[model samples]
Target: MKDNKQLAGPRRDTIETFEGHENTILAIATFPDGERIATGSRDKTIRIWRLEDGRETKKWGVKMIIGALVISRDGKQVVSSEGPELGDDEDDDEDKVLSRFYQWQLWVRDAETGRVVAGPLDGHTNSVFALDVSLDGSILASGSADRRVILWDTTTWRRNGDPLLCGAPIACVRFSPAGHGQLGIATDKYIQIWALDRRERLAQIKGHTNYNGSCNLSLSWTRDGARLLSAGNNYDPVIRSWDTSTWEQVGDPWSGHDADQHIYRIILNPAGTLVASASSDNTVRLWQLSTGTEVARYEHSDDVLRVAFSVDGRFVFSGGLDKKISQWEIPDDLLTTARGDPLSGRLKIETTSFNSPHKHQRQASAARGKQKARVYISQSMYILTVNQNLKSHLVVCGFMITTSMFLRHF
Candidate 1:
């Protein structure tokens, strides 16, 4: 059911805790369909979750602890970095004698049935640290401990070209949000930008330093691909955004997480307006990307390892040592798009325009800045009504119109 209440004070964000994984949840990815999510955990199993209700829809096992996961653009296939690892040299058991041998490579599987569709794509010689699929799902990028970032052609599930070599082991890799033409690769010391389409290294950014050397940082591209965001851990626990065009830092590094823990991962919501960070401090936090202002926080039982956003940007999913995926409800009235901007089309514009205040409404919105804005929309009328201090603040002569009339204007 939709929440329509216009209450006072800060928005009350609620969370639904989902329990399933036996070990720490290491990675999370939302299905393009928005109805489901895929969570990868140290338990060596990936579980499908229904978003409408906290239901574990499906499950599949892999050979090693899942390091990363990305769903194909069509929402049909899930690409995961999987493989086995050795414990102490004296401890010969793979999983304490679990599995003696297994291949460590990227696996592309069917989203519905968990069937391998294209790969055990092989190239990297070590643990896979990152995986990202292009917007069109025509290409896939995988970064590994071997210091190689390999691009694969999704159609043939084959290596697209020679691996993108780096000076140090790769911590993460991401395809630009705007398209597949550009890629970002990170090592402990610096982040390298590459023009993937031309097979050339563009520039290297040294904005972040990973103190612990775990190579556990993350990278994300802004919606337009004009900027890139990166975060690291240990002594250098901070989130940094950079301009892709100039490869320049955007603003001061964002800091809120505990100084001693690692920020496992960071992702931007679909609208690219909000940033969500998962950390070892046992909390997932949401921030305004433009201002770096901390917006909301969700607590976990243990270290939070990964976070994801629904395609609609209405909800956020976080998972970690708690062995669960938490679904958080974004405030209904919190505008998803930029302030004072209308949605792209009539259907979407109405939802956005109603939230964003126009120049004429600035004076009325100033006082409501510290308060939540409630929007009332119906087929009968489009009214700019705001609720605050338990009273209605109506702008523009306090008038409302029918839905058809509103549609005609947009």
Candidate 2:
């Protein structure tokens, strides 16, 4: 099936807008039922919204800026974390001495009743950058700036074991999609798979170079738990798929973006055939998993910090520095268009032309040599002109004209 044509659907709609955040939104989490959307902002608050109406359902204030957010698998709990803060001092000498104590807290809340269920989990000694919940909703995993990953029992609200050690700050963490006791972790340059049952490092795949300061931004397990994907802060953005059985790199890295775009998040569609990436370049690119080919690139005016696919995988919700939540529909037709040749299939290029303020007319003159020609499509007509012909071009370019039209349809 050639998925080349743009999917025909309603234009994107603004579902809801939340006010009160003084800074950019950092992270967002959606409930399993798709009824509630939770957002963590630099304003030190987590706001819950009704997905249908975009109305503010609830808001909880934290002491510091929240960097990560996650909802439990059962949609009954939420976990949020703030970066570490400084301690208070009493005397002048004590105040002059800086104390470097770092702390992370996880707050579990009831999704429907808006009640705090468990904590303020205070275990990690640094900023909590990533959080994930198990399929059974009984286990929670957290990655932190202190170079550790921790598993917590959701029911008992206790640590599962000694924190999984790492060489660098853990940037992302996720549970296996098969509902098994397997987890994935990403740091600066390594992707590590750990077995939850044995509490042992299963495999570590390392080859990619790390960005100077930023770490890998996202990790996801394929639906069947047979593969894993990782995206990060390199100029050559890669979507690496690894076999779950042997933990080997299964295929070539998906590389299309040449600009130094940092991928902030990656989510595989429920069908396991499509993968979507939210990036720093203010766009979301969707790719086919089997072929590692780009399907569509959704553009935004500002940086896209996070993105999530609906449970049915028909719509994508993206949030970013713009402080607006935009919903994009993934039409079957657009997917069809993307699968075909973009350059030769129904080519459409929109351009603008402005004539000089002065009006002038020149005779039709022919150049001596036949040079390579390029076609420029304006709003109304196709401009078949040579680049080096100066006298003919300068004489007739005097009127300022504006036009708007489509290129082709078939």
Candidate 3:
């Protein structure tokens, strides 16, 4: 039987666009249930939108540009970072000129009313770049250019531990999905995993150079917490992944991204089979994790900075420099790749061997041209059939047959 692979399409439908921000949207976070979205913008405003109708339900203004945002899992609260002005005019420069007298702040607010609940979470000496809450909602981690990452207890609204002395200015931080008291910190050229429970480094992953100063880059983990994904900056435009079990790069970097454009954000679908990346190249791409192929791409008019998948993984929401949020839908067959994977069971650990790359021996042949493509395809099929020991023989044979047919047709 043929594996259910849909014919590739030229485009994905944009079901709706949310607009209201007067400036570039810098941050976007969706409710865990996917019913609502919260965004922060360079316009110094935050808006909450009902995803169902693309309606802005609440809005609030702040004193400084909003750079990062995160919504609580329950959808009851939101937190956003304050950043430098969107422009560097003399007046803004003068404000920086008097930096000795002022400090920036982060806010935690009621998600529905836009009311500040607790904040000016004041400790960082510089602009806040990233924010993440622990799985149980008791701890919040904030990263800043001040060269520190702080843990704050939600109940006391106070710092939870001594400042994490990351020597370089912090770029981004994310709590591990496993909730095993782990934190992913990206600073300068390294991605460090810190064990919050022990207050020590758990793993130090080195790859992907940093681009600019802004916390525009991001880090995400698969829902299973088995794989971690890192988006690249202008200095490094490839999306790299690491097996959490060993904290090592899984395969050759997923390339084809524009080296000049920074891959601002990356996220995985709820099922963990697809990865969505938003980039300065004016597009959002969905990559098949198993094949490492970019299966779908959606176009945007300007730099696309942020992207979020709906709770159901049915839709993708993106916002950016264009001052608009767009929703995209993938074809059903493409989505089916995620559904009943041997790794997706609720309580079972994903031990599928599909996580490893298929060692292709025809690189030189394929690189030459179509004349050698047929030979390359057959060798690839042989390798797939021989190397896959964990997946069903029928499934592997089906994939090989499908690829053989595609190559013949080509």
Give lDDT tens digits, candidate 3, residues 264-349: 88887755578888988787888887767788878788889888877556788898989999999876777666543434211111
- Could you give candidate 1's per-residue lDDT for residues 89-172 as a string of tens digits? 564755643442335678889988998887777677777868887654677888877788888888899898888887777888
List TM-scores for all candidates, in order: 0.76, 0.72, 0.78
lDDT of 2 by residue, 1-410 (tens): 11233532123444345455566688878765545678888777788887677777788877777778888754567787776333434453643433223546777777666577887788787678788876556678999877888888887989988889977878889876554467888887688888787788888876244334445667887655667888867544667777878877788887654356778889876435578888777777877777787867776667788887664456677777877666677777644443331221122232233441111111122222332222222222222121222111211110112242211111
Enumerate clash totals for all models, in the order shown.
Answer: 3, 13, 0
Cα deviation at 388, candidate 1, in Å, is 44
On TM-score, the candidate that comes out on top is 3
Q: How far is 247's C-alpha from truth in model 1 (Å)? A: 2.2
Ranking, TM-score, top scorer first = 3, 1, 2
Clashing pairs in 3: none
Candidate 1: misplaced stretches above 4 Å?
A: 1-14, 88-90, 93-102, 210-216, 336-410
